[model samples]
Target: MEKDKWDKKITYPDLYLQFGSEERSFFKEEAKHLKAKYDELGSFCELKKFTGGHDYIKWNEEFVKTISKLLKT
Candidate 1:
């Protein structure tokens, strides 16, 4: 097996199995903004919300639901 470009080094192309393009982009942009904010603030702990926090969590829960649905299909 090969290492991934990102940290945690999961198998390449495997993340796509868990996310669609838009979902992946959303995560990427969120992470990017978090990094930039961290750099400016001199700390990386504050995860500024790009979207509403509750909505984001709810959406993720739905995403898990979708995954479950897909698995059941």
Candidate 2:
């Protein structure tokens, strides 16, 4: 079966119950926001790698690092 066709078997609630109601709600909200952001980013898919000129090596490296940092956030 395709991965996308599969339902989520369980959720955060089914895990440890030490979380209070507020914490659980916050976790769900944050998860929703992150999911929306990733979907938005996925919609702007890149077609191909942008190869850089030799002279732009430093600039390209810095650009990649910045993108990585942004993704982490």
Candidate with the greatest TM-score versus the true structure:
1
Lowest-lDDT window of 10 residues in candidate 1? Answer: 11-20
Q: Over all chains combined, what TM-score does candidate 1 have? A: 0.29
Q: Model 2: residues >4 Å from true position, as ranges?
A: 1-23, 43-73
| CA lDDT, candidate 2, residue 43 | 33
Computed on alpha carbons, the lDDT of every model, listed in order, comes to 0.45, 0.39
Candidate 1 local Cα displacement, residue 7, angstroms: 28
Error of 1 at 11 (Å): 35
Query: Candidate 1 clashing pairs?
Result: none
lDDT string for model 2 (1-73, tens) is 1223322442322111111233345654544554544344443222212333323564466567656966799
lDDT by residue for model 1 (1-73), tens = 1231333333222121122234456665655554554454455332323333335565676567766866998
Q: What lDDT, from 0 to 1, does candidate 2 have?
A: 0.39
